[model samples]
Target: MRVRKIQLKTFKRFDDLTIDLGDEPRKIIVMVGPNGCGKSSVFDAFEEKQKDFRPWGGEDASFYSKAFFYTDETKKASTYNRNNSILIEFYPPNAQSSRKTFYIRTAYRFTSKLNVQTLSAMASIFETRDEPLSSIALDGRLDANYKRLLSASYSAFEAGDKTGNQVRAELIGSINVILEKILDIKISSLGNIMDRKGEFYFEKGNATNFPYSNLSAGEKEVVDIILDIIIKKNDYDNTVFCIDEPELHLNTSVQKKLLIEIEKLIPENCQLWVATHSIGFMKAAQDELKEKVQVLDFSEKDYFTGSHTITPIRTTRKNWQRIFKTALEDLTGLLSPRKIIYCEGRDQPRRDGTERGFDANVLNGIFSEKYPDVLFVSSGGNTELDQRSEIAISILSKVFDGLDILVLKDRDMASGKNTTAHDRDVYLKNNPSNHRVFVRWEIENYLFDKEVLKKYCNLNALTFDEASYDGFVVDIENQNIKDETGRIKNYCGIVSSINAEKFKQELAKVITPEMTVFAELESCIF
Candidate 1:
């Protein structure tokens, strides 16, 4: 089933939005936009329309569903429960069950474990419903998919007198075909069901007999979508297969291949709808499908007061530029950096609202003006940086040819060796030439240098207070407070409650060409 028209008013992030696909909509509808651009809300409208609707003390109307809208004027912003705001029109003009018309897979998709106690019957399409609106609702399909796979395989094996593996191959051979073609991997076996180890086993490269849980997040995503479609395609023949953020955890190359494979797997009568900011997927949909794909630029729509209509835009260079900006934002211009330094610490924020990528941010602030195109990334701790830096450099090199990537780490202060020339030589001899160690114990230690602190005090128009500063440094050295971040915070708390951001700014201001610390950093980074 294809959606011919959609009208939404006072929905999430949409005061009013309408999309009208004339008599025949394209086979594939790819909604491209930045995050929170009402793409997912459009899918929400479809799911909500299928719910069983019953107004207060009214009769049950299964085809009709309840939706929320602003009943108390646009200014008050008071939301009320109602069922009149959302309307979805099907091409066939017949009401179908939620499962029969719409097969939805939300963005948050993951399955940690699959332990099968007994085979469960698959829900009939007529009785099945759509997923909840919550994006964090995990896609618990792997376990159920496994049960269905086993049941189908067992039936085929018994009726046709086929071998266990052979019967299973018939059920999942198409899935394996796509997996092998895109990821260079295939399902080696469906582990023995009698032992309750019905998890999927895969074979890739030299690795064999690895459990389904061992697959990468991207690999698991591809497997989950392909397997589910293969098992349920017949039941949802004339359906609008909607996948929100299908490129989750997948790289650009994999996303392109996946889009092609998904289009092939969808039934001939069914239409595909996807909400994504994936450049690879969008490019593939346009270049490959051409007229068969409708590119709805959600980023261009007007989401203001009254009703507004939106139609597919031509995939022109201008249109593409806008989409790319929506997808990458500020990073669009820096897609290919002159140099990338993989340093220590996390790139993600901590739960307590602590700033992440501290090392990278500091380095960028110091060198941005001098080397404008150089990028600093916080890969992880020392060990993780050693491993992931190589992988990142390898993959990124393939994507952006001749990309200069390097690794940087802190000096090992656990040995109690002073920051001397001899120690620096020893560290360099043991590590790769591209992987350099800081002259200081860590990056933060540079901020607390006697000269840098004096410069900071002068810049802030405060007294030097050399006696107190020297005593604190001696105490820290005696106590062996290794965490330079904590040391900075402690000292700042005592003197003046300077936050990390302000501390970094003052530290950057003090790091000049005349300072010996500047010369040391230059030697290591350059």
Candidate 2:
């Protein structure tokens, strides 16, 4: 079974919200937005729905209690009608069967404790043998429950119960896999004495028997969540696992790795819903699950209403990578560059044997004093630059105001006086004023000016005759050095035995307003 849709009406902090999880089992739904934008509120709505939910063949309660309600407590004497409700639709795995719909209307209460009566109802629902389905909600209090359940399971396993032993074995195996892959440590054994608490002993090569309690807080948090899922795996089919703030107490790296690991623990029929503030987790999930993941941005602006809107940012399977890249860029402040210059290559040595600095560094070195607001970013390659331009433009247009974005490409092997004219026409028609291309074959070719080369050799105290250098340049041009990148490397090998990067730096220093490429760059930026 899978959640097909959820509709919230007058719910806490939500006037009207609908989330559509596509009709597919094993889907991962990710909720993202700024604080107070109703990310957690969506999870709360789901939890509310789960409280009184029963399977298809289960008995219904005559009376259901509501704890939380939407109300204005400050206006006690005033009259207002408040009806808060959540409606969720679920589709059974069988294709021929119709979808199952469930809903609940309740008051809004801000409390951490679970309702005892509701818990009893949930217990009864799970106890029913026919069509047993389970739901697990995880928040901040995972560590305490993790320890209690883990210790009890280990004790039962020690008592020689087959079921307890199976649970212990499964938990240990899963935990060890996570530890090894994420932390590079193996679990040699799970240790326990007659009256002593159980602990995990980690092994690394010759190093063995490190206690579980010795793990860092972040590691412990990861283990806790994974263990909680493992312990609860047997109780549910078509399960719904809701995790709010899964990144709690974890660093960026752990946040990413833990989410990837958690995905493995989810059963094939189970659906996972995550509410996260960490871009790291979002990015990691996107990479791991790809199109199986759905991200809803609750903070999107509704231009028609002139207020922030709650909706899933529509994306296709092919475009999800681009969407997440833009989101991650926004989260990390990469979009803060007022004037973004898209270019090829990242931190490769220039033709003049300069130290490794990609287009961004080269442009920065030359243009920073003139245009401090401009930020040059390497797109890793020319093709990537072209493919990602639309996504970058779309995301930047929404988040940035008065921003100037441009793309700079190399002429490559294509012949044209205006090297970037075709690309500008094809890709930059919307912002033609901001796009540019190097006059020469590539940025490396532009750095090979005779005057610049002569000056660079002299400054570095390298022995090179100006007449010989002029002859070498003429020969290279005569040979039609299309691969300027290779030619630069070869030129550096002949000119200086020292680092080629230093020569590129010297060339960058000598670059002046007279260079045609520099003039074009200046025009593109302004």
Candidate 3:
């Protein structure tokens, strides 16, 4: 199914806002936000627009309005917390006519009442309905006036030991299939899908001794994931998949594989949505779907009201053409294990102490100005890994398939120890270095003796250097400090000129103008 637009009025935090999703067919829609920004509210609001109209579980027709709209108009509080008129116009796939589903959760003027009444489950079609659809087929079909419940209808509870429709061995069978596909796990059969509310073996397979009560938390979550996928894929064309942290209890590999399956398996007639905080996991998933994917940044104004505007950040075709190659090469560079001449610091600051050097503010500086496709980021140090991951993933997901990231970390010049191996492994989840330098170190560290340093650990040179690149090698000198804090009181000597120049040169190889645009994504979290 596809949505035309969504209008929120007096929803929880929004006073009045409308979002025009435009005409897009069966495409995945990713909405990201900090916690409590009403991203889930958007999904919940969509549930209210279903044909059965029992999403909120209230008996009275007006009950949904009051509960889902802003509570007090004077205070500008709308129901569902987003507080904007929440309306969605949806068109089901395989439809011959221009039939659609529209839901509005806004206050309507009451002729006799003093206050306006909130409206929800306000679905309408272009052709007009003489009476609201009363009964729907539970076998997974809907009449014309009623649209299927996208979010509410799909849920996979923990496997309870039961054999009937509520919980069954079928769930375990399904889970085994997924585990086999993702984690390469294999077994004759698995424990049953249980009714967790009672914590009993609601369904037991004849071959199994007992239920999944003994299964590990990770295994249970594996079942949870498999069940959620099956339910969401039930009526693939009509399902509105709302997965909350599908990465829950999953390792990076499983997370990436599951995301890949969902992207490939979900029918093209339906849209898929996921909310997650895993940067590395997302990087892997984005790579799997690089050629066919779209991401929308909902980081701005999670709630909208009067003139409620959502800043659209769509990863488009232009974005792919712009940043894909550079990101890949950067990632490949990091995977290389040689003497990575990390260039850093000022290129002799201009009169303003910003124009000429490695000023991060200047998008067209060393990295971006120098590299068109490669992505080199000024991480400053190890503290920026999380923020850098987020920025890097968002940008690279738009351009390439995998994370194209190169983080230049400073290993004390005097000590001669390499931090590239340790730091790169922390983010990439795999040791990326065989030696101190990388395979692609030459691409960025041309001015510095990166090739020579890998062989000799003795040079780091850049613009305005007093000595050759050989003077800056980290390990050749074997200076000081791998203490508990890994610090040298006189770090003045380690943060020398040779290493700084190498840092800048490495940055100059990757970050391009397009990748720099991601720097302006208006991050709400670091």
TM-scores across all candidates? 0.58, 0.48, 0.44
- Model 1, span 378-483: residue lDDT tens: 8778778889888987788888866788998777533455556577778689877787877666775676776776777677666666765567677321233344
Report per-prediction Cα RMSD to one decimal: 18.4, 18.6, 17.5
lDDT for each residue of candidate 2 in 304-389, tens digit (9 for 90 to 100):
12223334544432234344444464444432446777787663556884434356667777775445446677765666776676
**What C-alpha lDDT does candidate 1 achieve relative to the native structure?**
0.72
For candidate 3, lDDT tens digit of each residue in 353-442?
343424233223333322223333334433444355456556655665543444443333223444353453353444343112222112
Query: How displaced is residue 52 in candidate 3, in Å?
Result: 4.4
The candidate, 1 or 3, that scores higher on lDDT is: 1
lDDT scores of the candidates, listed in order: 0.72, 0.55, 0.39
Stretches off by above 4 angstroms in model 1 are: 52-83, 92-99, 125-136, 301-304, 330-526
Q: What's the C-alpha lDDT at position 392 in model 2? A: 85
Error of 2 at 39 (Å): 1.2
**Best TM-score goes to which candidate?**
1
lDDT of 3 at 120: 31
User: Of the pair 2 and 3, which is ahead by lDDT?
Assistant: 2
Q: Rank the candidates by lDDT, best first.
A: 1, 2, 3
